[model samples]
Target: MIDKQEQSLNVKMYINGEWRESSNIQKRSIINPANGSIIGYSEEATIEDAREAIKAAREAFDSGVWSNLSTGERAEFLFKIADKIIENREELARLETLDNGKPYREAEADVDDAAACFRYYAGLITKPSGQTYDVPAPIQAMVIREPIGVCGLIVPWNYPLLMGVWKIAPALAAGNTIVFKPSEVTPVTSKKLLEIFEEVELPKGVANMVLGAGSIVGNEIVENKDVDKISFTGGTVTGKHIMRTAADTVKKVSLELGGKSPNIIFADADFETAVDYALFGIYAGSGQICAAGSRILVEESIHDRFVEKFVDRANQIIVGPGSDLESEMGPLVSEEHLNKVLSYIELGKKEGAALAAGGSRLTENGLDKGYFVAPTVFVDVRQDMRIVREEIFGPVAVIQKFKNEQEAIKLANDSEYGLAGGVFTQDGAKGLRVVKKLRAGITWVNTYHFTFNEAPWGGYKQSGFGRGLGTFGLEEFQEVKQININLEVEPIGWFK
Candidate 1:
């Protein structure tokens, strides 16, 4: 268990293999959203500090110390990092719960997944890459993948450590240096992750971190010419800004952004299973997931029955501090995010949606001090309602009814965002048929919120572009180069 003094220690930014204070010495108080108490302090980086990090990453890449290492050698570092993460699993999970306001079990699962991600990349990078091609007579051709140097990795407060690992592991595996920035409000776990890198004796300047607000620090990384790529997991609006900024230098950009994914339940689905998964879809992590199934679409015939069971489950969810093992759900990440969620609930009522279960904050049982909101559900919501269309990013969901498979498909794919979606039905063929029509990048037949490190994750359209995880993840950080050789020295004829 983490003691009080250990929990509240000051965390410094990691730059060029050293732990140091911010250039301006600005620090942000890290609050435990579960109890609304100040848990720690993290240095807030300025533009100058962000620039120094980028410079360090660029110099590290150019030095060939890390980039020139063999694939097997680099894999060794990743494997050690993975091993250390498991060794520190319990402490990191507690820190995650304290800093991010997630349930202890959820935090533990995230820690395990984070370690697994590192191991996955370590093995993937060691595989034989590049392909030889057949070409015209006397000519040999091939293609090889090389790392794009000096990556800029920016992750949101939700799933802080896991998302950071999602980018860091692959970039390092591809032999690139990086400037990593975690959200200022939740920098605790990220600081610990960097410390793990230090423990593994990762090369100097190969992995650097700058902690601060996105407006200053993130913009610096996006706008810097020396940074070769930007991998961001956050809101779509910020992603658009990054795309435009990176365009100036034509830096490769990978964005995994917003989602209002759909969870469709047909009448034929197992009643109990459908109801349980529907609650899990939106209530896990207090519905802060990027690919959360916030929009539930049910067949018209069984709509009422489904709503009744789902709302019952939502009300039974225990809302309390993440440290308590009894707590099934935790508070929102911060007071500001809580207000944003509450305002959305009000808007839903004004838009004429009926409140099915909860629509107010939970103040009883000492929850008033924390950023707690009851798991909320709005039924009879129209397809055009803002509450149904927009991503609330909270434990709020909207239910809508559909007539048939085609109608369900239409309703599910109507949204501008298409990150993830799910279908639940007894008919095996029907499940596949519906899943194929859904426009999201990630989908499940009868499950929700189940993701694997071996599969790719991303979205289409406004949900942002590019993929993360699997071999596709390694490809994002690499540049493809084509090469040709003249077996008979015949290249001179064309030039002559």
Candidate 2:
């Protein structure tokens, strides 16, 4: 358990490889969402601070001090960072749980995956890059990939360290200098990551962390001319604004935005497994995941039974502070987010959805001061209901019935966002067919929320563009250049 003594550690911003205070010497309280206590304080960076970080990255990229290194050289730093993360895994996981209000075990898993992400990219970058085209003989045409300079990476609070690493590992692997920003509400792990970078002796300005609110610091990163690309993972509305702001400079932008993904369970699915995953999909991470399967679409024949089973499991979830070893789920990240989720639940009821189980905040079990909402489920929800259409981003699930596969597909694809979804069926062919037609970038046949660092991740439609992870994620930070050589130069003069 994190004690009040941990509050003595003052978190600072990392710029140009140095830990320092914001220009204005401003700071914000870093609250533990589990109990609304001030765990620590973080630097509240200003526009000037953001510019300082950006200028550092821009200068580093132009100087080629870090980017000029061989792929093998860059991989060394990533490998070291990954090792350090593992060495400090327990402390990092505890920080994540306290700062983000996720269970300790989940936070530990995130830390492990974060390390794996760095290792994956370190190994991946050493592979062959660029390709030779089989154009006409002697034409000698080929395309080579190079790093895009000065990336501004913005990640949401939901997966603070993991999401930030998702961008950091690849961006660094591709040899791009970066100005990274964590959500203002969750800066603890990012600060720790900066310390890891410093310990690894990553070149000054290769990676800079600016801790501040999005409106000031994030806006500066987006609108700044020196930044070559921006990769953001957050709300859909913020992503749209980023797109609009980035267009001013016509900078490259990749967004991994919001989703209300569906988990479909056919009557033929293994009933117990379907119910189990459905609960895991929404309740894990307190349903704060962008790809969380908040919508459970069940076959009409088994909808009732599935809902009954799901609700029972949801009610059984132990909601408490992440510090508690027995707690299966933790509080929402903040009170504001908790209210937003509760509002959506109320909207669902008003819209005629049946409140199946656990709608209100949990005040018992020593959770009175925390931002805890009980695992909520709503049945008989309409497609048009705000609760069904919009993202609640909490421990909430709404189950809707579909008569058949066609109806299932329709309900799943009706959303404007297509980040991720899953289906469960005994029939392999049916699962594949439905998954292919789900209109999502990431889908699973028998699993939910299972991700790999080697796989491409992103979404279709409003879920945002471009891919993260895998070879595609590495390419996101790269620019392709085509080279053509004229082997035989013959001047055929048309003019006499």
Candidate 3:
């Protein structure tokens, strides 16, 4: 239970259109990462509770109450949800900041982005249906897309609400009933979103939320035979586990896993813009982003200058509580994550990388009680070093120099994960050429971490399969069927 001394929040699970406590009567504390305060508590659902959510989704899908609605009708509900998000943007943003330890401004932006996602999907749902093809003889053929029954959506803690919308909006717009599992670490905004769902009068069992540990709640979502598909965003290890478990039921799975994305800067690039983006790429979200450009491959010609500028900027970042609004960076999400990041920093030092700036935890002033880490930068990093190769998921960046464009491409593609990469070059032809060579799914030419709802987002190699956002994301929750009709029947001579 959360301490009554701090602010209290409602943290009930939404199952079958009702907000209720966990069946097992267990609860988990929700911490405010900014100051290590107990902000709220959530129902810790058991496996049985998870099964109930799944059953609800299954029944809803079978009922066809939501699935049978016209595309335009479904779009209406999504638009309403978007409207509600805008109406309560500040409140939702504050809750997100409190739960996830991101700056209030960033959390607000996430709220707006989430609303935009729903609106985008709303417009998309009404645009197209399927394709009709002309066939030889008297047969007519066509392909149609239909909902894939009950969907299980498991989202992570970093961009809690936005990631939830990313999965839910598309799943709902595709006309599939959903059972969403938000990370136990940050379930505040998700519970609030369900409140909006109730306000919008979303049909019973059409959308459900189960709050608990991943081992129980998430496992139920993956292994349950009733769930037609599972869309997961988390670490690669957990993703692999979901894949293995879902295989028993042969459920359709779409995973957006980990990344060790590369941000390459060439000497010919705009120096100031490249440097700023390099910092933004890694430092934004405290480097907790899956697409955080943790690996920086700089052209050897400008390596010294870039590192100098980058370090100067990183040192100037104000670290404090997310609610301060004046602070540029906030604390890590939890004590455990902070220690994990510190361990990685130590590993980087032991592996012989030079700490350029901001390499240790900050406990100055009132920040001692918070999980704050200084924006750390390391130069002279080797390609094979753990700091350079792994996803630290902190505000840490490693700088390595590449001699030429060929070497830049080689180093960028050397990773087992290929979620995203960026190349900064002023030459248009050279930028396109390098972009084509990068193995990542999403690559920015002169920009670093800009993503739009209209563009496809996913990765190659071990970064996981399938796509999210844009038209492709909508298609992930749908199944295609080919329908053929014969206008005339003819008997073969051999049959007579």
Candidate 4:
């Protein structure tokens, strides 16, 4: 557990293996959303600070000090970082919970996942095999994969450290230098991660972190010509802006954006299991997850029964400070976010969805200062309602009824976002059939909101473009080169 004195430590931006304040010395307060208290401060990096970080990464990539290391050697460095993460797991989890307002158990799980990600990528980097093409007359052809040079990683506050590790682990494993920017709202764990990088004795300028607002620091990372690629995880609006800005240099871009994922429950599903996963799906992380199953499409046959159980379970959730080990749900990230979520609840009423349970802020007892909202459930929702279509990053679930498999598929695919969805059924055939029809990158048969380090995670449509975990994630940071060799030293007739 972090003591009071440790919580007050000043956090600085990391650049070129050194921790320093912003060039302009601007600082932003880091708040503990669980209690609306200031935990510490982080440097609000200037455009110059961002540029220097980018330059550092570019120089490191060009110098080949880090990128030129053997793949096995690079793997060893990633393993060391993974080990350090395990050694400091408790502290990292505490910092994450404090900074992001998640339950300590959830935060601890994220730390484990982060370490696993590094180890997974480390193993992948050492695994041999590029494609070898069978050539026609007296020639050999093959494809070689190389790092894509400097990468600018922009991570969100929802899962601060885990998201950073998602991008950084794979990028580094692929031998790319990085300039990362953690969300200003939650920079605590990110700062700690940089310290771990230093502890692992990673080369200078190989990994950099700039803490600040999106306008200055984020924009610099996107517009900087030296940065070869951009990997961003955030809202869709900001993602589109990054895409447009990166177009100036035509840099490689990978995005994991917003989602209004659907969780479909058929009448044939195991009633108790579906009810449990339904609550776990949206209420986990207080519904801040990108793949959160906020939109529930229940078959009309089981709609009424499922709604009853789901609401009852939601009401029983223990909402309190993340530092409390027994708490099931923590506060929202900030007061501003609380207001936004409340406004959405009101909008749901305006759109004519019945609030089955929880529709207001919880201010009873000592919870007045924290941004606390109860686990909310809405029934009688239409496909076109804003509550059903928009990504509400809160512990709110909108339940809608579908007549049959075709209508269920239609309602599930009706949204502009398609990051993930799930189908709950006991029949193997039906589960496979429904999953195939859903227009999502990932679909769960009996589960929801569970991701693995071995699988690819991304979206199919406007939700986002590129994949994030697994070998595909490493490939995102790599460039493929096709090589051809002539065995007989013959000149081409066309060139002659």
| TM-scores for the candidates | 0.98, 0.98, 0.98, 0.98
Question: Against the correct fold, how does model 1 do in TM-score?
Answer: 0.98
TM-score of 3: 0.98
Tens digit per residue, CA lDDT, model 1, 250-340: 9999999999999999999998998889889999999999888899999989998888888888989988888888899999999999999
lDDT of each: 0.93, 0.93, 0.93, 0.91
Q: How far is candidate 4 from the true structure (C-alpha RMSD, Å)?
A: 1.4
- Rate residue 331 of model 1 by lDDT: 92
For model 3, state the Cα shift of residue 199 in Å.
0.5
Model 3 per-residue lDDT tens digits across residues 1-496: 1112337775988999998788776578899887788887889999989999999999999999999999999999999999999999988988888899899899999999999999999999999689988877688899999999999999999999999999999999999999999999999999889999999999999999999899989998998999999999999999999989999999999999999999999999999999999999999999999999999999999999999999999999988888887889989999999999999999999999999998898989888889999999999888889998899999999999999999999999999999999999999999999989999999998898899999999999999999999999999999999999878876745764
Candidate 4 segments exceeding 4 Å error: 1-7, 490-496
Worst 10 residues of 2 by lDDT: 1-10
Residues 373-481 of candidate 4 have per-residue lDDT tens digits of 9999999887788998898899999999999999999999999998999999999999999899999998899998788988999998988999999889999999999
List pairs with backbone clashes in candidate 2: none
Candidate 2 local lDDT, 1-496, one digit each (tens): 5432366557898999899898776579888888888878888998999999999999999999988999999999999999999999999999898899899999999999999999999999999988887786668999999999999999999999999999999999999999999999999999899999999999999999998899999999999999999999999999999999999999999999999999999999999998989889999999999999999999999888888888998999998988888889899999899999999988888899999999999998678899999999999888999899898999999999999999999999999999999999999999999999999999999889999999999999999999999999999999999999888788756787
Compared with the true structure, model 2 gives a TM-score of 0.98
How far in Å is the alpha carbon of 14 misplaced in model 3?
0.4
- Those runs of model 1 whose alpha carbons end farther than 4 Å from true positions after fitting are 1-7
Question: Which 10-residue span in candidate 3 carries the lowest summed lDDT?
Answer: 1-10
